[model samples]
Target chain A: MSRAYNFCAGPATLPEQVLLQARDEMLDWRGTGMSVMEMSHRSDEFVEIAETAEQDVRDLAGISDDYAVLFMQGGASSQFATVPLNLLGNSASADYVNTGIWSEKAIAEARRYGDVNVVASSAGCGFTTVPDQTGWKTRADAAYLHYTPNETIGGLEFDFVPDSGKVPLVADMSSSMLSCPVDVSKFGLIYAGAQKNIGPSGLVVVIVRKDLLGKAHVKIPTMMNYQVMADNASMFNTPATYSWYLTGLVFKWLKDQGGVSAIGELNARKAKKLYHFIDTNPLYSNPIDPRFRSRMNVPFILADEALNSAFLKGADERQLLNLKGHRSVGGMRASIYNAMPEAGVDALIFYMAEFAKERG
Target chain B: MSRAYNFCAGPATLPEQVLLQARDEMLDWRGTGMSVMEMSHRSDEFVEIAETAEQDVRDLAGISDDYAVLFMQGGASSQFATVPLNLLGNSASADYVNTGIWSEKAIAEARRYGDVNVVASSAGCGFTTVPDQTGWKTRADAAYLHYTPNETIGGLEFDFVPDSGKVPLVADMSSSMLSCPVDVSKFGLIYAGAQKNIGPSGLVVVIVRKDLLGKAHVKIPTMMNYQVMADNASMFNTPATYSWYLTGLVFKWLKDQGGVSAIGELNARKAKKLYHFIDTNPLYSNPIDPRFRSRMNVPFILADEALNSAFLKGADERQLLNLKGHRSVGGMRASIYNAMPEAGVDALIFYMAEFAKERG
Candidate 1:
């Protein structure tokens, strides 16, 4: 089966090994005489699938017993509201550090729930830099510090984890999760939409400190209640079973690849190679600060605007795919998540060189 | 490949044809050079998949332009909260008809958002029947009247639609949707989790009257706001792409089987044959009121209590899978959804006869 280097910034590329296993098991998972899709969520087989997946995720993250890992739906976009709904306790204000488009979106959604203070914002800089922690104006009365460490849209990320002091550090890790190792204890809650490094779309894995539970707003919707989700092990209702199963396969695959630390090193290498190629090439440019360039989603632009569409077409013809940048930020972005192999990045680098020689 | 007669209630059985098609396309869908799972939600190809699925669903339900078909995540359990969050509008109270377990869950969730008036409930009768509409005490000022048309747990169903006067009628059709022809004009809204008759677990299809667009509570989560979802065609966020595509395939299969009407006839025949066997056999019985018995989910009991475990074991050995009843109403259930072929039902009947002869 032929495959392409898909960089669609999610609902994106998954490991081929995971996909093949999923295809093989789509009809009947492990001789259970029923497809994972066809099994009852409450059955022993399904329960094992869910528990094993959660455990492996915990293992990969090195999570402790003080947290609850919830397998939920509606993506991280939903989590923008869910975070404020389930946390915030009685606080009127929450701190937000905006690095790029995703953080802006998260901040807007949080505003609907309560007072969201823009503690630090680099939006004025065209989202090319992460505001230094020293400049952050975090509120003492804030419920938490919410930030997007990696913004999938702007090709920017924070170089260091923020220090929130006594306040909880909550993060929307949709684009960067599992692209590297994360400190579980550093955040009150961390949620990632699974389409990136986890599994598929429609599933979001929320890792929240256990103490943060039961603080949901009085009017919070039942499904958004973290405590309810926690108590039921993310089985408050029937979960996205097939997606969860696929996640289990991915978790297993990650473990086989020597877990997150090993994957992180490989990811770093890919980012270094791709960024190095762009940095030296006068024909292409990545304007983000080198320290702030996202290792996961890399957005670069052509020196000549006339060659933009042609660049994409040529890349597609060379089997380098989904290199188009998000419409919100016009240019090209290659989101090399955990699933994107080094070979794929090498191919992209090769294509860039060939395209530049032919058109420059 | 080697298929089994899977009888799971939801996250339940899908057509063999559908599964095969999904497997074949899992790696690369329609020569797009990317699996449907890998494509961007914004890609022209993925957009077409989402739109075509929605259009075919609209056609299957005979939905008019006045209605908006929304593809969402978080399933029907999420919709229990979403329905009220979006529809409570200016009204402080809503009417609900409680028929079984699902209705009770819906009532409990809606109460968290607004005052829910349970117009009628059959929970007192051990949830084996549906309360008559004449006895329903629906309020004139109720923003909407909500009810479950099919209680998958008790195998009970509402035989007729409730008349809510001018109040918008809403129904949770999770277990009943697309099982038979539906009059889309009869209700202001209908939502169903895709697992049963539609597709996989994470996706939900919401058919709402166009007028229900902007009535969401000001505090409604962005993902749950019907107006936003309709305005964006359920693309306000990245949707459950793979599930949506599978649902599209299922819709095609349903249409090929002569649409819902033809499927309805076949479903009725399957229900009739299985129920007839239970009614005639002294060794088995179904206690639900005949008029209220659901055509999709059939719950029954062996006359000899001691043989329950053995019956399940023997059924599994015979390849009649997932026949065990819901834990809440345990004995046995043989859910025959649209994907369940009549031959599978015949195999089940044959197994039942053989087992009965041996044990009786």
Candidate 2:
């Protein structure tokens, strides 16, 4: 079977070009006679691969020397605990803005370590919209202000970065990172699990300010300590070397496609096309607020609930896989990350139109 | 260049056949129209891949129904802290044997969570031998008794499993798991970083007795909680799916090569052949006690340390790579994990003999 336009929420689609290169180099990488997975993390060759990847991400993201870019394992979920352990040094409380499921998860995990003050929440609205920042009651002495830039499950996204005053701003960009241009200087730390816009599932890229180092709680596991990881250049242990290498390939591919600015334009166009079709077509509806709808994951529902399965079946037949919405919210979600070509979006739109005409 | 005999310790060699299979399936896995890495963890195709891999490992290791196998991230180093965080529920301390660097590191990390009682130590002998179990001063009240079954860097291994009696026994089998068959019923938990006998880094296979679940410290991170992970079938969050899939392929390959018992016989033969050559040759020497020498990692030194560069240079020219010893212990180390075939061993020995004959 030929490759399909995968719409998985995570472990999502990668650029076809990147997958081709990986397949070609699976046996022997760069004439080294070893796959990247087989190479010692400390070897000169792997170090170069690691370093090149770090540099490419840094270049693409416009990260500066003031921040240390770490390639970590266990994804953003691990960082949920790591952020509080590292950033909540002497502070007894931290602020959080609960936008959706991801935000609530972060809030719950943060409560395990220290006081988590949910300065604002969108639960009153059934998580279809982001709460206005003007209504938030953030604390000045809070260690860090945490929020989900994009919630993968709920298809809710923050259209603006919340200002934290003196407190550091930390964003879990797992679903939406690299889909568009992001300013590195605005946040104390920014993290994205590689499965989304990056590469594979096991690796998470953390961009943290240099000053936010060495303040982890005493009981924090060494691996969770951002300081130790940053010091070792994220090679504190054997990393997901293959995942890291693949992520590097993605960063290079993004560069070749004219960096985040160019990809952002393509992403915006893709999201606009799909959302436009959903709104104009009488048979489909999306609950998310138009202003805060995720550009990466667009969740929509069929006008007739009975037609959900048929809509999905037709989409699958046309190679638009994993269009099923998250189980929590029963409908359909089309996750068109940076790797999903515009043609793929066009195909999905075409399928949705045909299904609506025949069934709706 | 064709594949070289990669002997670098962890993130070590993989079976060539496994790499080839992964290459062939990189773009589309089993006609799913998506790479395994791109599949949702909850998707039927990925779930099947995950389940098959889990079942294969269980069969290969002879794990019983009483054990819950967890595919975790952050490697064994993460497990060092996780063991104590979860198991040290009410106990004040855990018993550990300080065999070498790996043991010392585990002990050091375990200490941060609870009192660690070093039951025995081979540090007095520069870690060349394992301390006898009879001399160990283990505490009956200890939360668990932890030991490094095989030390990758020191090239030392325990010839016998220690009798922890009522206390659950934990072993870090990162380097020697599946090299030989072992009775899983005796262990409370067995953890291995999956870069050695298993495939790739960033994935750790944890086999834990079912009774040990649900007893974690209040402050334990959700990701580090054993019960949470077990209850979710190691899908507490999106796991290292691709790594887990590759590891499953390796396990299938192991079964194809006959089970652990057959591999054990082959492993013994390979170790014996390599050690026999090192001991008989006047120019080469291995300091480890013959009985305790690691079958997986054989660290040996040249009689004249000055010939080290020439030895490595000649070996590399012949495509025998990563033979250099760890920087902490600098001579030469050959990590012949299960994936390193007998032919690779023969090639290495042939090159070693030729180098000694010409340079001696």
* Candidate with best lDDT: 2
Residue A296 of model 1: what lDDT?
Answer: 94
Query: For all the models shown, what interface RMSD does each have?
Result: 1.6, 0.7
Candidate 2 per-residue lDDT over residues B1-360, each given as its tens digit: 999988888899899999999999999998889999999999999899899998998999899999999999979999999999999989889999999999999999998988999999999999999888889999889999999999999999998988999999999999999999999999999999999999999999999999999899999989989899999989989999999999999999999999899999999999999999999999999999999999999999999999999999988898889999999999999999999999989999998898889997
Which candidate comes out best when scored by TM-score?
2
Docking class of 2: high
How would you encode candidate 1's per-residue C-alpha lDDT over B1-360 as one tens digit per residue? Answer: 267888889888999889888988888887666788888999989999888888888888899999999999988999999999999999999999888889999999999888999899887889888887788888999999998999998999888887888999999999999999878899999999999998999899999999988988999999999999989989899999988999999999999999999999999999999999999888899989999899999999999989999999998887888988888878999889999999999999999988899996
Worst 10 residues of 2 chain B by lDDT: B351-360
Chain B TM-score list for all models: 0.99, 0.99
User: Once model 2 is optimally superposed onto the true structure by TM-score, how far is the C-alpha of residue A218 displaced, in angstroms?
Assistant: 0.6
Model 2 residue A277 lDDT? 94
Models, CA RMSD each: 1.2, 0.8
Clash pairs, candidate 1, are none
Clashes of 2: 0
